[model samples]
Target: MEATETVLCSLLAVDLTDYCYRVCSRCQRVLPSDNNGLASSSFCNFCKSKEPKLLYRILMSIATDTSVKTVICFDRAATVLFGCSADEFFHFTKLNPLAASMVNQVFDGEMLRMTLTRPHNRNAQHMRVTSIVPLRSGFQPAIVTLTHICTKNASLGNCSTTNHTLRKGRAVVLDDPNEETQTALVADPNQEKSQKKGMILPFKPLTMTFHNVNYYVDMPKEMRSQGVPETRLQLLSNVSGVFSPGVLTALVGSSGAGKTTLMDVLAGRKTGGYTEGDIRISGHPNEQTFARISGYVEQNDIHSPQVTVEESLWFSASLCLPKEISKEQKKVGMDEFYLIWLRYG
Candidate 1:
């Protein structure tokens, strides 16, 4: 409401709506959708409450009501939410001024803030996308939806503050309107005297640089050392290649030559250095589907040797699969062998 004054529309402070953000069609304002209703000048009851919180609640409700099914968020978290770093996404796909607008518009045109990192025991990277999208039902009304997507490709860097705020489901705001988290922030010092004004930095993707086991432990200390040259030993040396669902791929290598990194990537673990290429769980790739379709199996045994192999695998399966089932699942298949025992290496 504090932008330029014009008689074309009345700008008012919007606090009642939980999904307090919207992209104006004509002017493309990232302000609250007070009256962004398709119809003239009227904001309905649904638009008032059916925003980010309500949409997520409804989606969860539907997922539970159907008990037999699963759900997902519908788009890649990286491109959808981190388009603010259109410069970086340029490394993946080129973005022109118009294409940038198109990409951002479909993604609700709000600034994208995202982060990607590898898990400790897994190979794949975790990318967190935080942006607001609009959910609609024909011409009825439109409400904002808060979306978060984690994906493959690479570990994200530059998203510490954002990740902290998102983990708690809140946005970080500064007390001093003119103070900056860093000098890069554009704050009008003169305006601090005339009331206060804060500039909004569109969200960007934070990268996580993952490292291999041998070098990963010493990375933090190494990065802190002065006068050391930056090297590609981490970024270009990814051993955890990408994988597709239902496709049979093999990660063949010497015992210590990084086969496990390949396996970890497919499992979606958060490794801090190497880049993860891509991940697709089931046919529908979205934020929500990740929780269900994505499951991992470590090679080590979690059961005692006294227990039979069938009993052990069954126990592991029960952790993810249904607890109640017919006796047909009782069957067992043994295919255990160590790398050194085989002659492939």
Candidate 2:
């Protein structure tokens, strides 16, 4: 058997036996058990509490693909996994059977990197699951934070060799792939070397700026055919702003304020709208290439209810991800998408 200070292992199975134990919430000590092998009281002998609150800790067995299994206990990683505290999880399981079932699904078939320490007994090694990492199949969550896990806030941006900027007084549609298909985002010269050294550098962020942006829908041709004068409906007028990188900008307005219409025009989703003014990315006119890396979710639930969540994510990843990404990588990306949706949906 191989022995090391740190072991990167995939979870083969989780032992649900003695999965949970009750402890005094104040003193953080295990409480007495009743005849049924369930926690009898929340009282702690060490602290001597008249009325005690209780909490639970989860313990499970984890292993590599072909190695001997070892027992590991959850700490803050429990909260990270389920995005809730242990007390909350206990209450959730008691209240929501479906949510408890969902929690159970996470234990098996997960990959983690563990740091190992040998006890005085020396026969078996104990390990703590320190951090989650990508599995051999490249399945890894794209964005995880203390507040949220597996969020869609992160996405791939389009790569272009030739830089384009927004020109003044231009309202050009950016979905024409034929015009900029030859260019791809060039990789940084240091990225390869850094990856080889097991470090990944963050990509450069793009800054989008739109000035005096306006959109109008022309009157129907049939309406103009009669003596009626041709007129256009202005959806957005003289909207100017810079969406700088690393800044949270909210587009707040009353109904019919054209917030949605402005977004549609920027995303190239408006087919019949006439646009004016300039939309620049990093001081250059944005072209069709920018659309390659852009992602947009409709405000309404327009997808079919019959389609499963997995199918929907797979469809999106297939279309949005770069062609160079392999099918296996895309599958991993979809796994991440599913995890995020489960928490946020």
The CA lDDT of each predicted structure is 0.29, 0.52
Residue 174 in candidate 2 has what lDDT? 18
Which residue pairs collide in model 2, if any? 158-293, 159-185, 160-185, 164-284, 164-285, 165-284, 165-285, 166-284, 166-285
What's each prediction's clash count? Answer: 28, 9
Worst 10 residues of 2 by lDDT: 145-154
Q: Worst 10-residue stretch by lDDT in candidate 1?
A: 57-66
lDDT of 1 by residue, 163-220 (tens): 2111212221222223344212112234333322555554322111122222232345
**Regions of candidate 1 where Cα sits further than 4 Å from its true position:** 1-228, 231-247, 274-289, 301-345
Clashes of 1: 28
TM-score, cand. 1 vs. native = 0.21
The segments of candidate 2 whose C-alpha lies over 4 angstroms from its true place after superposition are 1-202, 220-230, 302-345
